[model samples]
Target chain A: MRLAAIALFALAIISALGACSKPPASERFLQDPQALKRGKGLFIGTCGAYCHSTRKDNRDAPYLFDCEWRHGGSDTEIFNTISTGVSNTRMVGFAGKLPDGEDDIWKIVAFLRASREPCG
Target chain B: MEATVETAVDMGSELALPEIPTHWTNARPIGHSRGPVADADLRAGPSAGQWLLYGGNYENYRLSPLETLNPATAPTLQVAWAFPTGTSGQFEVSPVVYDGIMYASSSYNRLFALDARTGELYWRYDHALPGDLRLCCGPMNRGVGIHGDTVLMATLDAHLLALNRLSGEILWDAEIADYQAGFSATSAPFILKNMAIIGIAGGEYGVRGFFDAYDVATGKRLWRHYTVPAAGEPGVETWAGTSYENSGAPAWTSGAYDAESDTLFWTTGNPSPDWNGDDRAGDNLYSNSLLALDPQTGERKWHFQFTPHDVWDYDGNTQVFLVDIEHEGQPVKAIVQANRNGFFYILDRNTGAFLRATPYVEQLNWASIDATGRPVVNPSAVPLEEPEFRVCPGNMGGMNGAWSGALDPELGLAFIPAIESCQHLQKGISVYADGQPFLGGTPLITDAEEDTAYGHISAIDVATGEVRWRYRDHDPLGAGTLAAVGGIVISGTQDGHAIALNSATGELLWKFRVGGGVRSQPIAFELDGTAYVAIGAGNWTSMAAYQGGTTNIPEGGNLFVFKLPAGS
Candidate 1:
């Protein structure tokens, strides 16, 4: 009986760890304040202010907050689109090229999502 | 003769009474009845008149009636006035001019009314767009439609808006498609009779494409026809599964209207999950096909599939030209298209029967013709679950970019701007989860240069389906073809020049430097027996991502209206 009880405890712990690894429904990784702050810094450094800045005359590329993803929405979808890139469009993939790889793309996506979210 | 004098006096009084420069410009209805002589014989040539319709006319001919300007003398044509758009977005629209006024739409849904003769702004209307509307294509408005006293326009957020021509007031507005599934409107609306027809854009963004018709006066939805077949539709069997419901078959360009036959001829884009045909198979009905529909009832008359189960994104969204041509000694009503898949198709407009299909460009590898007009696509050419496959025409194709061809009535030729290039495309399987699909592809680009014969303006005989003549350009021909009255075939090139060529022989007539590349179609208009040609010049190219280079052209957006000095 004790052995079975220990086995059940182990299984529950493993399942709990798995659940923790996945992002919660309420807590979007993209809306995390730290991730957005880091993302904004990286975006400014890499993409440069010419395209990422919010300006009236800057019609070439949309502002980071206002960038219309031709693909889909959601943090994961935006992250994947930014990482994988689109063909025949201006969005080029940064999969292996970005400094921090997938994590960096996720950060950028988080920053964009946070920026677009209405603040109280 | 008495009637002509009275008409002239009426026209003069009409022009004199309209001191409201802007109101006079936008108020000119679709088919302006009274104006300076617009006939081919009465003017210097057909290049001497104003462009009044979406594709210049309901026929989608892109031909003008005034002809005073020739390419040989284009350098001598003086600029009367220039109206700067002053906005920063790419303007992909062809301005509609009637009487002495011009109507145009900008990228971000800004419509402007300007004086055609003096380049003065009359009125501006802004359709307030939602914040989160994602645009698959760029924020581009193709053009606008004018019917009766109302000017019609389709917005990027999938709304059809009607404005009072004289007052720029929103008469009626109707939302055609939802923005959540990535559906939007970029193509210009076509006005026929009292019905306004429009097609949805968003094939790349994975939206089920459709075309809708609305009542011109009241914004009542008349009919909605799905480009992809639904469950019980005739072509539902082709999809073979539920995948058909989510298929992508956008009609991103304006359709041609045959007033005589009362048929609307339009083309559709490729099916979605763009690169892979795994889920949706069996010739994916209605997508990448030319459809002829009854404009009033929205019923399909006939359809001709160009690229069945299209995997290379070769959309049949080119302008469908309705022409009356003699095929094998019989007077046949036909529709001509310079398909994006590198083929020229001539179909019987009355029926969707294929008359002839010939390759208009050089590098085409997807399929070849047998005894019949059907394209036997090589199974190996189909994009597989791998990384790199060499594909001809790439995504651009021989006649890629945006161009509208002109059909010369007298010469029986269809003037086209064609590119000669190939691409290496790689496709991989992807899942459609969270509205995004995984696409893995690489393109090996070559052969696009100034010295190489990469692009040309060719005139093809519509009846014989043969290349009559071609004029090579240093850069790709970006603008559309315009056949004018004085035997002049006018076209714009990426090298920033508005060129006039002989419609019969493709001889260079005149060339005028427009300061920037002329990607928009050129229009010719006449006022008081004097002829003028107008073209919008700006340094913008849709294929900017494929080719990386600094644009040498000036970065200014302006409408240049040119005319011969006084009495010449």
Candidate 2:
């Protein structure tokens, strides 16, 4: 029992040494270029041009760059808005329609987060 | 004919009939002779000081006969009065004035009757909108149709209500379609002798489109003709598999009714999913086409398709103007329209035969017109599943059907309020459901900054489809036009101005900033020997959202009526 506890303690210390090492599986999708491309296609197809658009600021829908959220701009909040639509607007929730169901929303959030980079 | 009132107090004439006490209560009722004008009277065009038809006589000639406010004196015109509606919703009201009163409608299905001379409120009716109802487009109510003592209104929840002209009470409410299944109504119903007809909206939500005719007295739905055929119908083979069930072909705009022949002319919207037609192959018949139908029996007479298998969402649902212009040195009856597929077509109204198709916009590169007036699509401009396709004159069209343009019969010119834009369209897989958005592809739509898109009002000659003159604006012009007497073409601009241009030459004569984008249709009339022009400056439609958003147009909710200041 003591050895098991010592092993867990060592693993915990290793995780603490590099805080980013214990990231969620969904968080890693932000760096994967292929995953970002797929997420972009999904966003452009499903959400773009309905109310919001991907091009510059020529649409009635507020531009979705640089993190200005009408509800909340956090990663989790975006996931929620994408998973469950924003009320009183044309935005509809995408639950089963996405390629990977609910998991695709996390990829979209990551893709949008990375889009803020200069020429991502 | 001008309005007469007790203005100067009649001090000298004791022979003027003495006022009888309590006389109004016992006044004899005037028979139907002098009641609200009939549809036949409207078809003949309203006299000066009267606006009978929605588009000024079924020709869709939004022109007026009054010319009291001339171009030379228009600069001295000032605001006669300003009427305000409390709601800030979308205002597409093209008001009708008759019997010394003007009628208009606003968003959320509200109607207003105002005194034409003083702009005073007469009556207002608010349709009780249901909470569960949802609209795919912006909430807008085009102007109402008035016939006899009844005013016909098509509601946002897909119901047609006939109300009394004097009071604000509903006479009857006819449910046209089910709102739960993504069906709504926005356009004004065309009022006839004993029946009122209207079309269906929500084409983006996969609603199978149709238009129904209701009995004027009891509000009973007489007949409904579907724009898309059923599985076993004649046009079902055009749609593969079960795609015909959800194929979008909404007839959502006001139609022109020819009372003499009892034939009706209208247009249809795009097919679903909007940007992707891979699932449903073949030419989707009747969707992007001009259809002629019999209003009495609801039978299809004939149809002329503008865009066969329209994957670009260019709806051919604009106004069908019946023009009696020369064709091959012979006077022929023609139906002219600026099609959303980037071609201006003049077709034979009687047989639906194509006469001519000309390009009105400069950046239209998607298709070319053949000798038979059919569009020859370019393969390179067609969108694909992966790579983005750049198409000129995007899905918003070189011109939209939101407010049909005006026609000048004397000048033989059709003023087209046009836009210049391009889009990057891409196709993808779309899921179909009962009451959900069904656009199956992605599109980046805009008046593209890279191409420097702008707006223009081009006057196209009706005989030949050639643009005679062009009036250019900095922003894209998207409102309706009014061609009146004295060689003036009055039109609203994206910069919130009601401008009057010389009809023969494209000279800017008079302009006034109404403090908001004037996307509403303009109308002119005469009252007390003075001519006045009125326009509602509020546009929350897609064009306004696209142009007004970028132009920083102020929020607008007022209706302005202008005339020559006291003594010009």
Candidate 3:
């Protein structure tokens, strides 16, 4: 009887944890094998060396995976900034420049955001 | 009965002068009393006995009324003394002295209090600065302010600090703005009754700019007025969209205050993406504007936009001179601005009403005059392709190197250091990622042979809106004007020469060859009844980089004090 009670408590805890978990996305484009591969290629080609690459010397531009950004770090803010350039300094808007359009910009933003997240 | 009489005497003594409060120690309030009028020329000794306020009595004419140096006897102007700042950085700040104590700032963030008579350092204050902080411009502090016993100064890292005049201890320190976004302070703090006002620099680095005032005693932020209004604000519609949020409107230079009107007048720099306006369209209200705000509340009373939709980086950073002038036979409070866009603007000080706008320099192709006396900029001037677009007065305009210009009340003329150069901007489409975007434009070199294309000095008649006279030089560098008592105008140049020019004719009166380039404004003062002129000369990095030329001139950061031979 004692062993049965203990088993029931463990079962109840597991059920509650399962219920609290997030639901699966209706659509997950980032998980697509081709899209993820293409996204990585584009990020490396355009922004990989400049933003992702770290230098032993003084930093001219900030690192992408760094804890702080001179402007902002949120996913939406980064996406918007990337699409629309900052004024004055050399941040130009890429609204019509990208081949894949807004979708490509969004992909890059998602990758950057995910890279900043801690291990789950 | 005797004790009661003694108590009455003590009460009488208490009412006599009212013991100065503890907070009132460093406060030196110069009451707003009208001093003598400074003359246009500096040929002789300062007029009578008036030394007046910093920059000589509120008008900021910077002209002394003394006439001690004569052009005929030019050789008489000799080095009176040399005060070593004891630092390696360039010294761009002019020293302000009161009661025989001189206050000045060195390039590397050191403040010195020196004895006026002997060039002896009384005390020094070094505000600790961070190592990794990037300084877009050089580390320069213009000067310090003296109110009571307090010396107020702004740090390059955007901090306003008040120091005890007797000792070099910091009384209070307050941050002006965030440094990460490229915001910094280089202007000297102007101290008024219980308030210290300061402006920020960083138009080049794409920072949102504004000016703020703080409580003189406690360093409490009193009010902040943004040069560029945000979304839902009054000037939001002027911007095409949300780009106005980060528009660059730096107030890098000091402002002038009118005591009677209780108004502070300052100029703002150009809009962000400095050379391009494709994304952020419309006039971009208040970016390149002269703003008048209430000193107490920091509320905008009126604004006058000098350059609408400025794409040439034409900052209205020239000193705004507040003068009461007779216009059309009527007394009018007017403000005159020697604009960086190669133009002279005179406006009604009270209402921000347009009075007159005229070209102060020789060459300009970007704009023409409209019905409202505004520059109707040609859209072609905007960079669309990589073709070398010829634009005048180049990036550096009518007045560039330093804050040039002095109000000559004697002649009612504004003496300005004018440049006569043109630049070719190569514009093309550039990619934007996480780093600095290549904003499709670069400064192109066209004619390196024409050295005179870089600078000149001109005196403009404020009433007639005409250039009375001009002195041109082949060197690309020149200093701000200092008008003195007689009829002399003292100015310096990058060629390592400080000259006293005839204020009326622009003829060279007296010239002294300093060791290095004279970038600082020469200031004249009387100590122990002896008239002296002090200036700093040194090679700066910005000037060297912009000129794209090597300077063989020895770098000099020492202050040279000059005076007329004994017994004028």
Candidate DockQ values, in order, are 0.05, 0.18, 0.04
DockQ of 1: 0.05
RMSD of each: 11.7, 9.6, 12.6
Candidate that scores best on lDDT: 2
Candidate 1 lDDT, tens digit per residue, B6-54? 0122345645653322212234343344433222221122234456576
Off by over 4 Å in 1: A1-120, B1-50, B71-75, B384-389, B433-453, B539-542, B547-556
True A-B contacts kept by model 1 = 0.00
Top DockQ prediction, candidate number? 2
Arranged by lDDT with the best first, the candidates are 2, 1, 3
lDDT of each: 0.68, 0.76, 0.66
Interface RMSD of each: 11.8, 3.2, 10.8
In model 3 chain A, where is the ten-residue run with the lowest total lDDT?
A: A49-58
Ordered list by TM-score, greatest first: 2, 1, 3
What are the per-residue Cα lDDT tens digits for candidate 2 across A22-112? 5543477888887777676566555555556565654455577655678787777787787777665656676675657766777777778
Those runs of model 2 whose alpha carbons end farther than 4 Å from true positions after fitting are A1-39, A56-58, A73-76, A96-120, B1-34, B128-137, B385-389, B449-451, B545-550, B565-568
The better-scoring model by TM-score among 1 and 2 is: 2
Q: Considering summed lDDT, which 10 consecutive residues are worst modelled in model 2 chain B?
A: B21-30
User: What does the lDDT come to for candidate 3?
Assistant: 0.66
DockQ of 3: 0.04
